[model samples]
Structure formats: structure tokens, C-alpha cells
Target: MRRESGRIPRRSFALLVLVLGTLTATGPLATDLYLPAFPDIARELDAPQAQIQLTLTAIMLGLSLGQLVIGPLSDAVGRRRPLLVGFALFTVASFACALVPSAPALVALRFVQGVAGASGAVIARAVVRDVFEGDEAARFFSRLMLVTGLAPLLGPVLGAQLLRFGPWQVSFVLLGAVSLVSLVVVFFALPETLPGSVRRPFRVVSLARTVWSLVRDVRFVGPALTLGLAFAMMFTYVSSFSFVSQSQFGASQQAFALMFGINTAGLMAGTQVNGFLIGRVDTSRRLAAGLCGALLAVGVLGALALGGVSGPWALVALTSVFCVMMFSVGFVLPNATTLAISSQSPAVAGTASALMGSLQFALGGGLSSLAGWTASGEASLASMAVVMGSVGLLAGGVFAVSARWAVRPAS
Candidate 1:
């Protein structure tokens, strides 16, 4: 699963990037595209606010657990099969979600959708590592994020527009239709990036050993955890933003969509900058700088939020904090993933990628749920902001400490 000899052919290269980028976007589509519908869902299903938030938690948990199984299965078998199977399952789950009668049923279906969606997200990264290594992999991931980031930028706006013409169910129907398209593309265009010669057996003992090995490696573990916590901070906002914008700031749905898009634009810009800085500046230095920036951004956000500010100034300050936090994440994630994956055996790229993805969402899901609970009814951003600030500072500390004592991957 090391870098393939010579460059991929131009047509094949374009095809890979296009398909993988779309595939990488499924998770965002699943989460972000339906965000504006939360209030509608709560009303229609007769569910409490906490329960609606828990639905989001369910999906995150499903995504976290799904990668743990799918990654290893891809390692045992091949990338294409799992992708096709997962897409099919995702399509069905999404369609079912639109038809579910109760909040609990919808939550259950969303969990299945997340599990099915995990295939694309997990495999896209595995395929990248399958084809490239080291800084090249980092650059490719940043480029991939450039494509993937667009989903978040446009998803909420898309959802809001859908809600204007129809019910919230329309969003799920749209998810199904888009996934059907992804299925066709994967089936026709994606190749088995992991060839038979290098594929590993899917043994429980072996999987455990590989995971444990990654955990024991300080270089991999530190950046991996840093990536997770950074994402958790971002997800804190993602999970809480609807309430924050609407309840705390008194924004209309359209205004909220516009604001969400603006902040996501910051994230998109950061990915492009990350791609540029990949080889020019060392990835480690860039990662450390990103974490430091995130720490500062979240700290300021927490301070302003707790200081009891109000009006447009408060809204502007919050959006600024979010943009900076997202910018930092865009820089940190790809570099951390590149470093962690580079440390593992190519034979176990799928397993390693799976562990990283699983830990990220698992941590993210827990943190998101915590934010949701703390912000319930009251819709207080201050508590969540403080938690995010703490996480940002901790992630920075971890990166600094790991760089001093951690083992570097083999060149």
C-alpha cells in the first residue's frame, strides 16, 4: 500500500480525485445538510430538544463504530466492495429515514445512515494512503479536503432552501438521491486501490494488536488525539450552532444559513492554504502553529461569550471565533493524519486509518453530546465555548509534548 511507482495517469488521477472527494463529502452531507431542519423535526416528532440533539449524537456514534469494522474489512478484502455495499446501505437508510413516523425511528435510521456513510469517508483516506505517502499524502488530503469542505459550506443553505419548498423529509430524500449518484460513480469509476498481494487477513487478534500498536506509538497517538480534540471543538459549534444563531442571536433561518456558509468559507480557505504550505513549511511546524492559533481563538471566544455581550457585536465576535477555529482545524487535520498514517505499516493502512477515524468521531460524538446537554433549552454558548477553549489548549500542549519525545516514522 506504499506509494505506487511513478505518477498515476492523468485521466485516472482526475477520476480518483473527483470520486474520492465526493465520497469524502458524504459525512458532511449527512450531518450538515439537515441541520436547519432540527426545529421542524423536534416539532413534528413531538420530541424534546435534548432528544433531538441526541439524534445527532446517535449518528456520530454510528459513524465512529462503523469505521472500526469497515476499515478492517476493507483491509481483509478490498476497497471497492465495501464502498459499494456501504453506499447501497446508506441509500436505503436515507430513504427510510425520510419515511420514518417517529423521532426514535428517525434517530435509528440516521444511525444506520451514518454507518453506511462511514464507508466512503473511511475508504477515501485509506485509498489516499494506498496511493501516496508522506508529504505527498498530506498534500493530497489537503486537496481532498478542499473538495470535501464545500459540502459544509453549501449544505445548510441547501437544507434551508429545501425546507422553504417542502417538509424536512425533503432533505433526507435529497441525501438518498445524492448517495445513489455516489453509488453509480463508485461502482463504475473506483478501482481496488489495495491489491491482493498486500491485503491482510481480518483476524480479531491481529486487529487488536495493530490498534494497540498505534495507541502505544506516541508520535501517532498524540497527533491523532490532537486531531480528534480539534474536531471536537469544531463539532461543538456544528452541533450547537442552530440554537446559538437562532436562540441566542435571534437570527432567521436564512440569515443563519448565510452565516453558516460564511464561517465555512473560512474553513475552505484554510484547506487551500494548507495545501500550499505542505512542502514549503514543515508539516509539524504548521500543525503546531495551527493548534496555537486555535487555542487563542477559542480562548477569546470563551472570554467574550462569558463576558455577557449582546447584539450584532456578539454575533460578529462569535463568527470570527468560529472562522479562526475552523481555519486552524483545516491546517491541523490533514497534517496530523499524514503524520499518523505515515507511522504505520502500509500493510495496515486501512486499520490505522480506521482507528484514527473511529477515535475522532468517538471523541467528537462524546464532546458534541456534552455540548448539547450543557446548552439544552438555555442555548448558552459560553459553557460550550469554555470547553472548546480548554480542548484547544490541551491539544496544543499535546502536540508540543509529543514532538519532543515521540518516535518519527521511517523515511
Candidate 2:
């Protein structure tokens, strides 16, 4: 989709990305900020572990469903209204979560928070699609990646800090405050990117048809599957790393967080490399290099796991390989997203973005859960690696096959 003719200043474009990136980061921020408080929440609410865990489940389910609803709605309504409403609701829900007396109430409110938070993740991409085309969108996505990618990984770390000063409720209070700031920013900074001229009316049957057509398009599904599965790989690694590092490898909490911080930095580094290579290197080659790097790292990881390796060397090996894998992923996500959203017509940008976002949330959750359950009790580095390797292969395979039917893999 071509942007409107007037050239947007670089400073303004960067500001726009920052605003949109924060919106995109909110879902993950809200999802993970309360994670460190789980133990306290369970104890205070007098709920079983299973019941308390439902709150996490509730938010994820809400995020997945919320994207499906809000993305298409934004296509019909225009970006500004749905987005502001979502930001407001998320802020309200964050405060409400802090005040909930019962575990069930918290779960319900978290669902609302998640649903509201979806506006940021969904429309941010649609807005990028609206405002930037081709190479510029890819570059912008790399920048957005820095915020959205880091927030959830950073959330628990920040939550652990909040616990030092106050009870678990402080996490929600902080989330509310941050989101309130986000709401204020959106009020003033973010404009309606989707104008009336290109807006699609909200019609159920028509929506279904447009979405179905998008699904049937090889171009959208290919990169989207690549994006979803790549995310599944990253999410699996992120969600499982703590358990694998500490439970199986016996790393201390500080040590694990340190290692986690380093690996996460690798992810950011990969994006920077990708950003540098955007115009110089072929996009498909960058994606291939990422997939190949992840696949190789995970293969080694799986072998170490299945071979019953252990001790400090195993720990060192795993951490090093994770850095490589995460670095590779920096290249994958932005390019994949660009391919998926940018290929679609401007009219369906919101729907397309939402569908991809939903898949990302759903697949990331589902695949990570699968790795956990498939591991039986207490996930190990090896099991996590196996899941990562399998997912990497699937992502690579899907992209390789699908790209043949439509666009070149960039190489």
C-alpha cells in the first residue's frame, strides 16, 4: 500500500513508531507484569494454584480473541477511535485489577485488560502499513521490534522489583499508570492513519469474505505462518528459559536473569543487524539466515538434551546457543511481518494485521504450552530446545514452500 503523497518527516515518522511501538508492547507488558506476583496472589486470594493460573490463561485467551475482534473493527471504524477506547479500557482494567478482592474477579478483569490491550498491537501494524510501504515498513518494524520484543521479557524482571517495595498489587498499579501515560500520548500524538476514503465498513459477511480471501492468499499466509511459528519459537524459549535454567541446570535466580538479559540483548542485536542490512542485503536472505541460525542452534540444543548432558558446560552451551538463536530471530520477525501486512490491500490492512496478531498470540501460547506439557513435569533445556528446533524447521519449511508459489524468498 502506497502512503499518501506528502513525505512524512523522519523525526515525525520516528515519533510515530515510538507511539505505535508502546501500544504494541502494552499487551505483553500487561500479560507479564503480574507474573512475579503469582505466589502472593494465590496465597492472598485463597485460591488453588490451578485457579490462580487461570488469570494468566484468561489474559492470553483475551489477547488472542481481542485481536480478531478489534482488528476488523478498526478497519471499519478508523484507527483513532477504537485505539483510544482500547487504551482507555486497558488503563481502567489495570487499575481495576489492582482492586479486585477475589481471584475470579482478577481473572475477569485481566481478560478485559487483555482485550483492551489488543488495540495497540493490532492497529500499530495496520498504521505502519497505512503510513509506510515496502522497505520503509520493514525498517520501521525493526525499530518497533526493539520495544515490543523487549517488554514482556522485561516485565517479570520489573515485577520482581516492584515486589520489593509493596505487595503484588503494586504491579497492577504501575501497569495502570504506564497505560494511562500511553492513553495520554495517543490522545495527542497518534493520528488516524486509516482515512475515510479507504476505510472498510463493518459487515459480518463481508468481513468473513475478506478474511477468507486473505487466508487463501499464499503471500499473506506464508510470511504470517513464518512470523507465527518464529514467534512460537521465541515465546517458547522466553517462557521456558527460567524453568530450564534454574530447575534443570541449577542456576541461581540472579544468574539466570543475567543470562536471560544477555540472550534478550542478542535478540535486539539481531534486529539492529537487520536494520543495517535492510537496503543493502536482500530481505529473504536475511530471513533465511535467521531461520538457518535458529535451526542449527536448536538442533545442537536438542542433541545436548536428548544425550543427557548436564553440569556447568551444558549451561554455558545452552546460554551461548540461545544468544545465537535470539539474534537470528531479530532478523525474522520484522521481515516476516512486513511481507504479510504490506502485501495486502490498504483496505484490509487492519484485518490482515489482526489476523496475524491473533495467530502470533495463539500460536506462541499454544506451542509453548505444548512444549511444557510434552515435557511431562518440569521442563528441561533439552525439551525446550527440541520444541524450538521443531518449530524452526516448520517455519523454515513453510516459508520455503510457500514463497515458491508467490514472492521470491528475497535471496
Candidate 3:
């Protein structure tokens, strides 16, 4: 259904935000909700560290690959149907994940779950672009980030709390139930955002050419890469933190959860700040500033890790740096996404959004896997920090170049 042109009314605005933001939260909810169970899953399945970590990688692969297909399908058919089907798949896969008796089986199921979960994030972004543009779009995304941030903030703590009473399998069961709720909500609350008049024809060759067009559009490619790299930095932290806190600093599961919450809180705060600032500052300027902050934070983080700092104070300091990194991500991501998707026409919003999401998840998953595989028994904070810092620097560089030549959305 078509929304009114210009500003959406308050009631509709509130409802759209609630539904889209919840959909956007699915990625983190799927990934982070089970993280506290990682160690336990490893032991229970008799899997090697790398193999266990591969489960994370596998899901990321699913998410990345799934978006490549789902985005175009959404563009062709409309948003609501793909979303319903995807969530149903996620729910079923989550239940299967709970019943899996081996690491390989669990990994396979998680991959399917990731593929299913990805529809929410990709489609949610496309839906936002379907209805908004320019600074308004950035503002909407920032506000959406405020809601999406809750997933990461509470996911680990909830997982840790659940572990207090039951085996890690319960976490998967819970995930299945959450997906069921999401499925019900989407079926009831979400109307088809893509109208028939603007829908792209579904064809493989046509979709490939459309994707290739986006690939060559420096206007789209630059910020897309920036967003991807920014996500890579965040996922690196997500992948390493539990090990880093527990193995390196002797933090218990609960303590690690607290630290995770603190970092996500920083991310949420940044998104809120962006929501306020998007009208006052240009999106490019805001992006540049956020990248600068990230560069500085990651630099300090690397130095501290390499210095071999230890103790509770050291953990506190490290967490503080990570918080800064997350805050920077909050600023960079929404703005970068605005820059990327706003350049595309509505006809290809799904394809454009899909391409961007695919790149982000691919980079994030790849980096997380590398971090897991390279680290020894103890956490390799120095190496992870260096990797994160280097990516932060590269993302900043990409944005600087892109902002100079990129097309701006109409105000």
C-alpha cells in the first residue's frame, strides 16, 4: 500500500518504526542470542574451537548469500510474502537447531536459520527507502537503530541468564519461539510496501544486470563498502568479546554479559545522538566525524592490547574503547546506509538494499571467522584490535573518497 507523500503521520510513523525496527533486529537476535552458549556448545558437541567458530561463519555465509536472492525476489514479488516465508523458515530452522545432536548438523541448521533471518534486515531497509529519502531517511534509520540496538544489548545477558537454568539447547528453542512471534507480527502488522506499479520483473538475467549496474555505480559502491567494513569491525568485537573477557581477563559469563550490554548501550546512545543530529548536520559530515572517532578508538585499542595490559582496570579500559568503537559504528552505519540506498530508484531498492546487506554480512562473517581461527586458546586481543583498526581506517578512506563524488538524495 502507498504511504502519503512527504512526512508520515505520527501514528503510522510509530507503527512502521515498531514493525520495521523489530524486523531489523532479527539479525542480531539470531546471532547474539546464542553467543553465550558458544563455549557450552563446543563442549557438548566435542567440537574444536575453529569448528565451533565456523558455525558463526556458516550463518553469516547464509545471511550474505540469502540476501543476494531474497532482495531481488522482494523487488519482483513485493515485501510481505518473502518476509512471511523467510520468518517461517527461520522458526523451523531454529527448532531443528535445538534438536541437532552434532556440530555439523547444528552448523547446517544455523546456516539455514541465518538465511531465513536475513530477509528481515534486507527487507526492512528496502521498506524504509520505499517510504523515505535524504536526511529524513537517515533520521528514520537512526531511530530504527535505537530499537534494533536492544537486540544486541540484551541478547547476551538473556542467553547467560537462560544458561543458569538449562542447557544451551534451550537458547535455540527460545530463538524458535521468538521467530514465531516475529512471524505472527509480520503476518498481521506488515502490509506490502512494494506496489505493483513499481515492481521490477523477476528474471535472473535482468537481476544480474541490475546488480552489475549497482556494482559499477561508485555512488552506491563506496558507502556500501564503508557500511560493510563498519559492520566487520562490530562483528569482530562480537566474535571475540566472550573469549576475550573470559579467557583473557577472567570474567565470568555474567560479567561478560554486563560488558556486552555496556558496549551495545554505547551503540544505542550513538544512534539516538544521530537521530537528533541528522537534521542539523549533513550526512557526509556526520559520517566523516564518526569515522574519525572510530579510527582514534581502534588505534588506542590496538596499542593497549599490544602493551599487555592486565587486571580489572585493564578490562574496564578496554571495554571503554570498545564502547567508543560501537558508538562510532552507530553514527557511521545509518548515514552510510542512507548514502548508499538513497542513490537507487525505488524499482531497484530491494536489489540495492540486498547488495549492501550481502556485502556487510559477508565482510562481517569473514572477519569474525578469521578472528576465531587465528586466536589461540587465550584471546588474541592485539591481533583482533589491529584487524579492527585497519578496517576502520579503510572504511574511513572509502567514505572520504565517496562523499566527494557520490550523489546526494534530494532534500
Candidate 4:
């Protein structure tokens, strides 16, 4: 919130970190926690499996659209009001989801829940920029990731436990309760991050200008593309994992959750590496390294999949490599985010953050959708691996070109 840009009290900083981390945690938790319940949900609602998967796409659409609206609004008005409003909406939507009887109704409610859930993620990054800049911002984000990454690791496990003991509704109830608690905490503890001096007019023309400028900026685009590609890779895995595990490998839901946890563990490891390296290396170099590493790992995984090597040990080996690629994700996301926000005017930080997030979600959503289309029989896993690897290679190529252009002397 509106604290002076000086030495923040350690306790206050810790609280701020907690709130920011919690805000960032919602989407990943929402996506991953319910994954274990997907097959069950399809059976209970008598919905086709493809239709059940579309619910995830619906949620992602809402998340992308919501940020487009909330980001600029937060810049125009203030961060606190929009965030609190969003949390309130999220709390209500989660309950609505829990109570919905039909698959279509639940899908509709999940879209609303996603819209509400988007605020924390969009605002959390803006908040980071509100207080810190450059490397400091990178460090703060890496720390936030430590907390946020835990959600993916823990969410599925928790969801598996819930589904094992209670009905699927129990998961939604848990989400609603978590939202309620976050709302109360924010109301009492979270302060305004953007001050009045930095506020911008919320006019449509002004918002359009901000978006135009952001899209045109090479510095912003480079990192944003990197982040988008990395996320796309991850989402490809998420979108196809159920089909892969069930049809291809015949793994139980519990086993699949455990595998998900193992993959998420790679994300945690990457975040730790990012925290260690952010302060030591140049951000651009760190990003390049990450992109390259992801490209290589994804390439190997794709090759393995394409070679028709389908066994338990082979699957685990390939998945493990993909999981390790997640570590590089840490190096890419925060750096790209920092570059985008730092390149923008402070008055339009909300708009900048919003566009960055919106594009990331839109790209990931598109990739996931593409993966869904490629879901033919058990070979969907191989298709997913190819898509992810291709995207990563493309991103690495962009980063390489950017570096060359940036370093070139006047001709």
C-alpha cells in the first residue's frame, strides 16, 4: 500500500508479502486443486469428458478478460477498492459453484469464479511494482513465487484428500472459505499500494493508448513472450495430463496427483534457483539461460514421446525432465514482468500489469485449447510434448534475436 519508499518494517513487509503471495496463489490453486476431481466431475454430471475440460477453458477466458477490466480500473481508481470488490465477488462465486447442480451451471459459475479470482494475480504484480523497482522487484516476486508455487504442489494433494473423504462440493466450499478469509485479511491488513498522485484517468482512449504503447515496446514484448511461452508449456501439460494418465498409462487419480506434485516440485526448485540468481546475474542473461534450458528439455521430452517409447519408466523420465524445465520458469516470469512494468509509466502500472497478465493468460489459454484439439486417443501426450517443445523453441529464438538486435552497433 501507500507506504513511503524507504525502509519498510520487517513485520509489515512480511505481512505485505503474505497478502501478495496469497493473492497470486488463487489461480494456480483453482486450476490444479480441482484437477484430481475432473473424471469424477464428468461422471457425476453425466457430461462428456471434452465438455468437462471446456470448463477449464471457460475459467481461463474469464481470468484473461477480468484482468483487462480490473488492471486499468485499479490504475484509475485505486488498488484497494477493486481488490476488495474482487475478493468479495470471488467468495460469492465459489459458493455458487459449490451449489450448482448441473455441469453447465457449474461451468458458468466457474467462469465467474475465475473472473473474481483474477484480481489477486493481476493486482499482486502491480503491488510489487508500486513499492519496488528493477532487481528489488525481481527479488520480491521470487519470494512471492516461493509462496505461490506451494499452491500447485499442495492444491492437488488437498483436493485429492477432499475427494477421497468428502464430496466434490467440499472443494468448492474450501475455496469459498479461503476467499472469505483472504477478504477479511485484506480489509484489515492490506493498504493502498498506488497513491493518488500516480492515479490515471480511466477513459477508454487512455486505456487503449496504454495498451498500444505496451504492445509496441520491444523490452516489454521480449520478456512477456518468454513468460507466455513458459506458461504455455506448463498449461499444455495440464490440459493433456488427465487424458495421458488415464488412457495412455492407466494411472489412478491418486497416482496422477502424486505425479502432479512431483512436477510442481520442479517449479518450487526453479523458484529457489531464481531467488538465488536474480541478484547475482543480469536479468536478461538469466532469462536467456532459462529459455534455452526449457527449449532443450522440452525438445528431449518431445523426442522421447515421438519415438513411441511408452512405458512407466520412460514416462517418468520424460516427465521428470519436463518438471525440471519448470525451474527455469522462475528465471523467466519475474524478469519479464519486471521489464514490462518498469518500461511503463507509473501512472499506468495497473494497465501495464493488466495487459501483461492478460496476454499471458490469453496465450496460455490458446495453447491449452490447441492441445485440447490435438487430444486424439492416447497419443495426446506426445502431441502436447511437441506443442510445448515447439513453443519453447520459438520463444528462445525470439530471445536470441532480441539479444542480437540489442547488442548490434550502428550500421
- Per lDDT, the best of the predicted structures is 3
**Alpha carbon lDDT at 351, candidate 3:** 96
Q: What is candidate 1's lDDT per residue for 197-268, written digit by digit as tens? A: 889999999989988888988978988888888888888888888877888778778777888898898888
Count of backbone clashes for each model? 0, 0, 0, 4
The lDDT of each candidate is 0.84, 0.82, 0.86, 0.78
Model 1 score (lDDT): 0.84
Q: Could you list the CA RMSD of all candidates, in the order they appear?
A: 2.1, 2.9, 2.4, 2.2
lDDT of 2 by residue, 1-411 (tens): 244722345658768778887888888788667665665787899986556656765776687889999999998988889888998889889998889999999989988987888888898988888878889888998988887767766887777677778898998998899899888888888877777888888999999999899999999999999999998898777666655666577776556656766787798889988989999988788888989988888888788788888867877887898899899998999889989998898789999999998888778867765555542554567668778888889999999998888755455
In model 2, the runs with Cα more than 4 Å from the true position are 1-9, 36-55, 100-106, 312-315, 374-377, 407-411
Q: Order the candidates by TM-score, highest first — what do you get? A: 3, 1, 4, 2
Candidates, ranked, lDDT: 3, 1, 2, 4
Please list the residue runs of candidate 3 whose C-alpha ends up more than 4 Å from where it truly belongs after superposition. 1-10, 373-379, 407-411
Which TM-score value belongs to model 2? 0.90
Q: Alpha-carbon error at 85 in model 2, in Å? A: 1.1
TM-score of 3: 0.96
Which residue pairs clash within candidate 2?
A: none
Off by over 4 Å in 4: 1-11, 375-379, 403-411
Q: Which residue pairs collide, candidate 1?
A: none
Off by over 4 Å in 1: 1-11, 375-378, 407-411
Q: Please provide TM-scores, in order, for all candidate models, with all chains considered together.
A: 0.95, 0.90, 0.96, 0.94
lDDT of 2 at 193: 77
